[model samples]
Target chain A: MIYLLLFWEFFKIGLLAVGGGLVTVPFLFDLTEEYSWFDKRELIDMIAIAQSTPGPVGINMATYAGFNAAGIGGALLATLSEVLPAVIIVYYIAKMLKRWQDSPYVEKVLKSIRPAVIALILFAGLDVAKETVVDWQTAAVLVVLCAAMRLYKKSPFFYIAASAVIGLILKI
Target chain B: MVGLWQIYCLFFKMGIFTFGGGYAMLPILQSEVVRKRHYVTEDELLDYYSIGQCTPGIIAVNAASFIGYKLRGLGGLLSATLGVISPSLVIIVLIAMVLRQYMDNQYLQWMFGGIRISVTALIINTVWDMWRKSVVRVRDYIVFAAAFGLMWCCGLSAALIVLLAAGAAFIPDIRRLKK
Candidate 1:
């Protein structure tokens, strides 16, 4: 039943994750609250790893969550369920390219979904925010990250490394 | 001939090189699909990307699946999808296993705290970026504000918000077309 539920949840994500990969964040965020598949901090780590590693952010996340929840089979099943809809939908859309090509209706709908997705993503950020700020010193890390990101192009690799060192030194 | 092996190899290379997929992977995809294989036109790729955004699933994966299925039916689709995902599976599995060992270490916990803070910052930055990109018109501003308020205050599901926004976005277009 757990395996089936995982597949179903990801499959639904495949069906309605508008605006792109990160939009799936909100769905999985809700899942952590609803089920014990993985927790919010783990999801935040998954995001960091997913962004740093190769592959689509959404797929990496699903794979990580699936691996954590079940095992290898679960990972395979979760990924399969997630991409199955794409194969079906894209297959048909390719066939009917004439009807859908640059369809204004499609563009407008997507445009609208973008902001909604941003809102949802921001909400997910708050979940991570709760776990991230344990003390004033730890809270200081958040302030620094936010400040560094705003100032210049600090490569993620360097940024993460610096943060880890700060954390280790502060022991927060 | 661009056989299954070639398809697999090419996509696998893409999986390895392309970090932070979706729109970020577009240029590489164009080079591989359009310039190398001539599987689809640049215009066609852009079209697929546009539709991919509206459709379910990741845009990059959808684009890959579409191009693969276009070039070689089910075999092409399987090869490409597997190729793109294989790298992540291998890397993430290995990383997860190693991380599992250090899950309780105090030092690692502190590191995770910093990483999570960084992630939160990244996510918030992403929100601002998306907001700037999407909310151009006054009407768009209204929809965006309404969606945020409804979701935050009412605790509505993203699915419901997307559905409502989609309906609202298309209604004006439909009315104009009717006239």
Candidate 2:
């Protein structure tokens, strides 16, 4: 039953996570609330783990949720289920592209999804900011980072590393 | 078997090296998979990135699955996923066990404080880049605003929000077809 639940939860996520990893965070928040598998604080901890880890944040969170629910097998099922939708969708999308590569309607529909994706990303940024930036110093770091990101074309890691160093030095 | 091991090693290296998670893994994946391994092309990597963005799971894992599936079918996907996850699983489990009692330790708290600040920056950076490249028109802005409002303000389900947006986008097409 737990395996089935894990599979179904992630299957839904995989099917509808149409805007990326960060976009799935809000959905996971809802899931956590619904299932009581983890609480808000644990969710925050999971986010930290997810951010620091190697895989996608969404996948890591799914794995964490599954692990919390029913151990390793649950984790495996959840991760696989979360990815199944994409594998299926991409396979079909690739096959269809050969035939409809020049279809204007398809092109236009994809283009229309762009703005919504951006909005979703922005909302994610705000949600992260609300959770992490609890005080003035953190807010300052966020502002400076956003400015650096906007003005410079350097890799994001540069800013991330710089901010880490600065935060350590300032002891914030 | 050797090829499978090689694929596993390649993704394991990526997993171990990437610091800031999915978005951070992109350049490494681009170099290793596309340039070095020659498993995928530059264009395919970009498409994977775009699709990975819209899909569930981590971008890094999604990229691995997509690339692996392209290269070696189901076996490729399994190996790649395992490789990408192995480092984090081992590390997180160790940390969870050892640091369970010391979670509130001052040094650990300070370290996390620093990391949290850094992660926020990385996330904001991602938002800025995605916005600059993707948000082109007023209609796009409207969609973004609407989606953000739905997700953050109304606390609507993401699934519903996306479905609503897709439905909204299709309305004119439906109308034209009916006419």
Against the true structure, candidate 2 has what lDDT?
0.66
| Model 2 regions lying over 4 Å from their true place | A1-58, A61-101, B1-60, B63-80, B97-103, B167-179
| Candidate maximizing lDDT | 1
What lDDT score goes with residue A26 in model 2? 78
- Candidate RMSDs in Å, in order, are 7.4, 6.0
What DockQ would you assign to candidate 1?
0.39
Worst 10 residues of 2 chain B by lDDT: B166-175
Tens-place lDDT per residue, model 1, B26-57, is 54675567766688875456556656756778
| Candidate 1, position A13, lDDT | 83
- Among all candidates shown, the one with the greatest DockQ: 1
Compute the interface RMSD for each candidate structure.
5.9, 4.5
lDDT of 2 by residue, A74-172 (tens): 676777787777766655555565467477875555556655555554565566567678889888877776676668755544554576577667676
Residue pairs in clash, model 1: none
The top-ranked prediction according to TM-score is: 2
